[model samples]
Every structure is written in C-alpha cells, then in structure tokens.
Target: MSEPGSSVAAVVVAAGRGIRIGGGMPKQYRRVGGQAVLTRTLDALGGDPVIGRIQVVIAADAAAFFETCRAELSPAVADKLLPPVEGGATRQDSVRAGLEALAAAGAPDVVLVHDAARPFVDSELIARAVAAGRDHGAAVPGVAVADTIKLVEDRDAIGRVRETPARENLRAVQTPQAFAFGLLRAAHRAAAEEGLHAFTDDGALAEWAGHAVVVFAGDLRNRKITQPADLIEADRAFAGPSATGSGAETAKDIAMTTYVTRLGTGFDVHAFTEGDHVWLGGVKIPADRGVLAHSDGDVALHALTDALLGAIADGDIGTHFPPSDEQWRGASSDRFLAHACTLVRARGGRIDHLDITVLAEAPRIGAHREAIRARIAEICAVPLTAVSIKATTTEKLGFVGRAEGLAAQAAATVRLPEDAEADPVDAQAETAMRQG
Candidate 1:
C-alpha cells in the first residue's frame, strides 16, 4: 500500500461509556462472540504486519476491566500494546489524548484512529486506510448509502421530512479514519486551542480544520456495536450455526468433520509455609500461611494449567516452566495458565469448560469462589458460566486435613481439530509422565 514498511500506529478510542448497549459494564468491555469487543479490535489491528504499535484510550475507572480484557489476547498481539492512557469527558478529548500519547512516543509515518466497538475491521481495510492516507493526507472509509435519504425537522412529536437528499450522493462513513501523523496532530492541537471539540470523528475534525478528507470504500460487515441488537448480531456471527437457527448446518454436517471433544485431569499440592497470603486460581487470598513452591505457589492455577495441557496431550505446567529454571522462581502462575491457553488455541482448539476443586481445611474457598471463577475465566478467555470451583477437606486424614498443605484437582474439557499434530516437546514430557 504505502511502500512495504511505512511505520503505522493506531489509536483505539474505547473511553466511551457505551450505555446504549445496556450491559452493566461498558459495551467495549462486554463479551461478544466469547471475546470482549475491545480485545477483538486490538487483535485485528495488532495482527496486521504493517502496524507497528497501538495506543488505547480508556476511562479512568476501566483499568481493571481493561487488564482482564488484555489478558485474553494472544502474547504476540498483547506485545504491541502501549500503556493505556486515561480519556477525557468527550470523544474528541479522548482521541486527542491518544494522538498526543502517540506523538510523544515519537510519531509514525501514518496514524489510524479506530473505534473499539468496530471489531470486524480487517487487515485489508487497514491497508487501504494507510494507502489512502499517504496519498490524500486524510481519508475515511465510507460505504455508499442504499436507502433513500431525508432531512427532518423536529417541530412536533414525530419529526417531519423537510428535504430529501439524492441517494447517489449519500455515503455512510466508518472508521480507522487515516491521516498523515503530522497533519492530524496539528489539526487536533489547533482545535484544542480554539475550543473546537464538538466534532464526532477525526475525519470531521480534519474537515473542519480545512483539510479535504477523501472517502475510500468501507465494508458493510464492519458494523459498530452501538446498540444491544448490534451486539447480538455480531455475537451470533462468531458463535456459529447454533446461534443463528435450527436449520443451519451443525459441525458434524459440515465437511472436514474431524473436530472432537476431549477431557483431561490434573492434581497439584503445596505444603504450607510462613506467609500471610496464598495465590489460588490467579486470585490472592488472605491465609494463615502460604504454599511452598518455586512459583507464586498457586495450586489451583497450576492444576488447571496442567489440565489444559493434558486436554491437548501437551506437557504439564512443570514440563513447560520447570522449577529448576531460575527465571520461573517466584513468578506468577497466571502466566503459566495463560501460556497453556495459548497452546490450546495454537492447535485450533477451544476450551469448553474448566472445573477445579480445592482441598484445604483453612482459608475456605467459599467466600472467594466467584472471584476465583472470574479470574480463571479471564485467563482462559472463556465465559464465567464455563468455569466451576468447589472446595473440600480430608477430614483430618492427611496433610490437607492437618492444615499442613493445600491441594487442588482440576478437569478441563476442550474441542480440537483431529488433524492437529502433537507438540514434539510436550510429547516427550507426556511419554515421560506415562512411564513414571
């Protein structure tokens, strides 16, 4: 598009409250197609070879939500993210903040301003935006309007049509609106000085700043999630045939029907040591003592990680992150679980469910079940409903009963492509485990 490598950066505006979607949280944070809208948006942009970096603008109160969302992304994609900046009151302010952040970090050749709600923006569309921006200085993707257009006046309960515009001349604009890094930055800076912050999109702001904004072709399927119905429609698109209707072909009915369901189990234990808290299932819990291990000693996450690896016939947590490795000593176990999930996804597999049971007489899990369930779901990139947590005691029979140690057993269910090959490194470990 703009030569082979033209140094592109993107600013994803996700600060909006998105109340129209009616979710308890912001619409961008809500899950559609089993993933957050913002996560999908980041993945789409980060997956592109041409884009070098990304900056996200979020509400000040959304840091925790954003972190959970970020945890769901692949490591490669997550690596492209910049520390998120807090947004302002209006969309214009939020965009300006993002642009300023990008500029401060050394501006790129071209900058793309995208909406986090539009998760369907593909690499081709991004490439087109870059090319058009380089050629025209400013360009926005627009789809030609198909319906009749009308101007309305609101003088009564129902607005009346005052004028009709020609259908051929009407176009609906969408984003990943592109511009020369210098040109857009100057426009935003000038607008801030002049108190001109009413513009809804960067394209409009550039046009207001006397820059001729060209319109390139836009995709119809690249719809934004502004309403609840829009979210539902997008969810159904990714959720597959069952989400659509009964008449749709099931997975078995389709060709290349090699997908199969499998289950794996794992158990882990850690002796209590001198500490004030314990990390379980990626959540820290106040306790009389902590577990003795090389890592954070998160027995729940350790067992779950092993379970996921076992599901795909891969290596256990220890096999992947050996305690002997100095780098893994005192490391967070969440990383191990996340790595396991990534391995499952690499082989074209999807986790169906994860269940964990903890055997501990002290630090009862009843009070922290929901939090643990949520953290695991976030790490696995699965719905909360798909995770189950339970706890029990050995009734003074063994180490767990005597409160000397905590143990956890986990089960993982996953669907994988039958043709997926076993990872050679993990295969050796699996064989060793069998033999031992």
Candidate 2:
C-alpha cells in the first residue's frame, strides 16, 4: 500500500444530537434531499482519490442505527466509511476520538475534520484543504458570513451593546479542516492540559495552541445543516444539483439519450437425450432426452444468465447457482434467470434488450420461439420488444452437430442511470422497476 502516501484521512463527526432536523435518525443519518447526510459526507470524501481513508465517529448506541440504515445508503458511501468509533461527551472529545482512531491506523500526513451533518460538501473545498495543508501543515475551509454578528443578552431586559466583531476579519468556518497529524495531536493534548475548552472549531484550537493556521476560500455549497432552516437550504442545494428527479441533466447535453449498449451472439447444438423434455430459455422443449449437466443441465438458462450477469459486472451463473449444490438438482432454470434479473436490478442497471438462441436438431424450436420469449419476458418483466429468441443447428459436424447436447447463446443489453451513477441499489431498483 506504500503506507498510503501523504493522503487525506477524512474524520467525519456524526456524534451530535441533531434535534433540529427532526428525524428518528440523527441529522447526520437523516436524508438530506434524498440521501442521508452521513451518506453524502462519506461519498464526497471517499470518492476522492486524494483521500485515502475515512474515519467516522458516531455515538455508542448508533452502531445499531448505522447497521439498520446500511441498505438505505449508496454503496459508494458505505464502502468509504471505516467502521465507526464511539464518540465522547463533547465535540472536542469526538475529535480526539477520531484523531486517536486515525493514529492507531497509521496516521496519514493530513487528517481532514468534518461534520457528517454538513452534506453539501464538494470536492473543490477538500482539494483546497489538502493542497494547503501539505504546504502549511494546517488549513480549514470557511465561508464569508452574510449575517451580521451579534452578542445576545437577556431578551426581556434592556442590555448594553457588546463590541461588534470585525466582519471583514471574520469567516464562518466550514469543514473540512486539514491539519498535519502530529501537529493536531499535540494541539489537542495541549488544550486538554491547559483546561481550555473555549475553542469552537479546529482553527480556533490551532490558534489557541500557537500553530500558524491558514485559511482557504471555501465554497458556498459547503454549508452545514445545524438547524431546521439549514435543512431546507441543504435540500434546495442538493436537490437542485440532483440530476435524477430533476431534468436539469438534459440541459447540459441535448443529444444525451439514455444510451443502450448492444452485443450480439449466436449458438446452436443438438442434445442426445433419452429424457422427454428439455429446459430451454427457462421453457421446456419437448424432447426425448435433456442436455447432460450437474444440475437440471439447462445450457440455455446458463448462457442467458451469463449474458445478463456479464452486462452488470456480476459473475456468471455457475458462480451464483452452482451446479455443485444438491439443492439445484432438478431445479427449474427459471430460478437462475430470476437471480440474474435480481443482480441486474440491484445495480440500477436495466436490461434494455436480450436475445436468446437455442440450437437443437431434434424438437424444432421455431414453433416455440414466441412462447419462450414470452416466458423470458415474464421472468425479466420486460416488454415483449425487449426479449428475443431464435434457434438453428449445424449440418452434423461437431458434438452439437452430432446431437450430443443442446447449446445456447445470449446477448444482453443494459443501461445505468446517469444521475445515480456509482450506486448499486438505485441501479437495482431502477432496473427492476423499468423491467417490471
């Protein structure tokens, strides 16, 4: 792993009680726009190659919550999140916990501290933090405050005005704050030693500890949702950016059709069967003997399963419904086809079209092509236009030519949702829904 280089370790603090967002799940776990804030934060950081590892600090009881919510999260988000550590009593305590976890894992040069509640993070802000931290040892993203500063007093009583802080000199700090591992550790230790807890952010802590802190221009899109209003704003920010529900993606490129890829193939064979029926394309072909195999020996189903699985990067049929299983003995080939469809749907990839060819010299497949196609269409739940079936045979040359067994080939075409790219569940759902 080459020690992972001077990579960015994103420490996402998901420990806070987010009452404002008002979901049973914490604000970090609550869906921002359509995605959970925790999920989006993990995705944003984990998607960056510059970021090597991500450590999430959650409350002790949140483990069950995390596990339960796993299916709701995108795979990209889930894969990036390191097993979460239990956070402490305060925000600083959580930071310390995160830092400790990072250290135990062989500390990266710079660890970026962030809040999982802040889901609107973009790559540019992280890139700035990493580039600056590499040079200056400490850097944090901040946005210019548009709201006026206020030091509030008793609401019912008249209060003297507190000195107004200089707006020009102030910045509303947003994460991620990137810092050298050793420097941040020492600063936290020093803060603990002095009994100082006045710091609000990593920048403030770094300043209190006498380390030179550098600021970078942060993005407006990097807003955090601490209150209810912030959630509304976060919704607008991300939903406006979403290409899925919104048709905004079409404006960027007009020629963009939901592209469907094409693949074509041919197969033929003759089965020397003593049996009375042959399973072909999940349909039984009336014959004297079925093709020989470890399972029901449906070569047609196996080939079709491969074509469908291959389109989605899922392994072949044997990899899933192994013929080695006693359970598969005399199993209906429809089960294998159903599983293949499941994989395609789970990945949000849809089978646009599929063609299956069965070559048999015995019980001519020409009369049953429509019935086989309809059966496949029913299993895949696609329109009849999306399914095809054909059959042919050689003039007695090879094993298939000599009627030793049945042979089949399939071509599967698939498409993935552009807006929800890098997600498997959405891919799966979209595929299943469209096919269904």
**Which candidate leads the pack in lDDT?**
1
Q: Model 2, 41-114: lDDT tens per residue?
A: 77677767678788889897576445433444567656766788998878887888889888888888888999
* Candidate 1 structure quality by residue, lDDT tens digits, 1-436: 3466568999999999887777445889776555678987898888887888999999986775677667777788899899999999889999999999998898998999999999888877888999999999999999999999878897676788999999888889999999999999999899999988877889989988999999999888678989988877666564553432111334443343245788989999999999999999899999888889999999999999999999988878878999999999999998899888877765657678899999999898888999998888767766678899999989898988888999999999988766565567778999999999
> Listing every candidate in turn, what is its Cα RMSD in Å to the true structure after a full C-alpha superposition?
6.8, 15.5
**lDDT of candidate model 2 versus the reference:** 0.70
Over 4 Å off, model 2? 1-5, 68-79, 151-158, 196-198, 240-436
TM-score each candidate. 0.73, 0.54
Q: Which pairs, if any, clash in model 1?
A: none
